[model samples]
Target: MSPHAPVLLNEVLEALAPQAGDVIIDATFGAGGYTRAILKTGATVIALDRDPTVQPHADAVANDYPQTFRLIRTPFSGLAEAFAQSGEAKLDGVVFDIGVSSMQLDQAERGFSFMRDGPLDMRMSDEGVTAADIVNAWDHGPMAHIFKLYGDERQSGRVATAILRRRVERPFERTLDLAEVVEKALGGRRGAPIHPATRVFQALRIAVNDELGELRAGLEAAEATLAPGGRLAVVTFHSLEDRIVKAFLTERTGNAPGGSRHAPTAVETRKPSFTLTFKGAREAGEAETVGNPRARSAKLRAAVRTDAAPWGRIAA
Candidate 1:
């Protein structure tokens, strides 16, 4: 497996500004990268991850930190419940590093990388629907929708048609086979630098994992759990993820566009739950990106919680 490195580490650390007595959450806890850094600052950390593969990593962090750290094997979307169950009333900071890790991508058996052949299992939690399950069973229309919406693939129709026709004869049980089918569907790469199956694989993974939905729920949970003046720093790897983060912060912070055409009820008007910590999203510095290519597309967006009630907490 490839060694994991947390993208935008400096940016995240700076945004959280951990203090000795502060309590923080490493919301994704993949490889315990951010948790390790936060622990270095003498803060207590409650880390969460849905992947059982990271349990050993979390155990190592707990061993290192002893009383100052704890790990919960759960999705970050369960942030509110996790905090409640931990008996921690509020949090000083929550840091979310969204998407797959280098460890997951490098391990062929995990099937996250199309570059290597493995079983067609792309599950982060090792639960829910697998990529093979979707590809082998989903109807062509819904399959095409996943490709077009999540992967932004223009050849979704052709690809979906190909997959349906091919799977009828023999279900795609391996990453390389599905990739080959996609490549053929798209006319064998046509000299594109990216693999022909890149987008298709991404779409399958996203659809199976319900990543966007998880993010939405997790953001809401963060709003509910953060203490007043607490920090939320999220690092997203793509435009879709970043757009959701930006919109969540924007609407929660009362900066949403005023709509005369479609205004929500006066009582349904949102109370500002957070304030932007910076002007807009920040990209990885040249030095960082040069060292870790994964940082190339990373974007960091942060906010400080206000005293106002969370969107769900407020009475309509």
Candidate 2:
């Protein structure tokens, strides 16, 4: 098995069903797990990831599938531009394995996991604001907002308050240092199955990388870049990411609200740009989940583009 162990691998492949001569994009090519699998099906893959650290793995894939694979160092949100530069008019398939990869979490320096003691940096790419920057500088209100909105932490305000109180003595420069403060604030784990700092760390990572914004833009870019009948498969590991994917597919497939009689409103007036591949998101099988704990939270949502032009674009 590949070290990357991409979550929902079989399900994503089923959704994509790449074929010879097909052009696909692995929009979040962490460790090249999906890329390699797609390349084996004879599809030409253009992989995108902003993290510079993935280059070595990208190189390995390129070495084996030299003619069919290319890795671009850019966020998935830039998939449209990457495809445009590839001289390909449109994509046949696009697969996204969303959120931080195991490779990142295992690297202590990445600071994505509170379990690992490292610098507070959590930028997916080399550039941009880091988790330390947010915790050390941002006001309590904004910090708490992100904790609640991004991480869904019920004690966001309390945690933010604790961070503010602690940062005054010295800034949070390490992951464990911040984790300890959050743990203390949450009353020392209280026999929780997971660490008390888990949600806060998740929220911080998402905010530092602008993950939610990137995901939205990436989906739009996929919509715009996929050819009619092209397939899209997105695997999300958390409710926040899953909700965005679910809502995007729902609206794009023309399942938007038609408004009740009391509150008459114009349902999405544009043509449906894509159709859902299945009725609902798919989850990993029990076997897969047992082998890969990360797969337990994975949800795969897929769709196929329609002949209609993308929303906001005039159909030619």
Each model's lDDT: 0.89, 0.90
| Model 1 clashing residue pairs (backbone) | none
In candidate 2 the C-alpha lDDT for residue 207 amounts to 93
Error of 1 at 155 (Å): 0.8
Give one digit per residue, the lDDT tens place, for model 1 in 216-239: 888889998999999999999989
Error of 1 at 76 (Å): 2.0
Count of backbone collisions within predicted model 1: 0
The 10 consecutive residues of candidate 2 with the worst lDDT sum are 307-316
Off by over 4 Å in 1: 261-268, 313-316
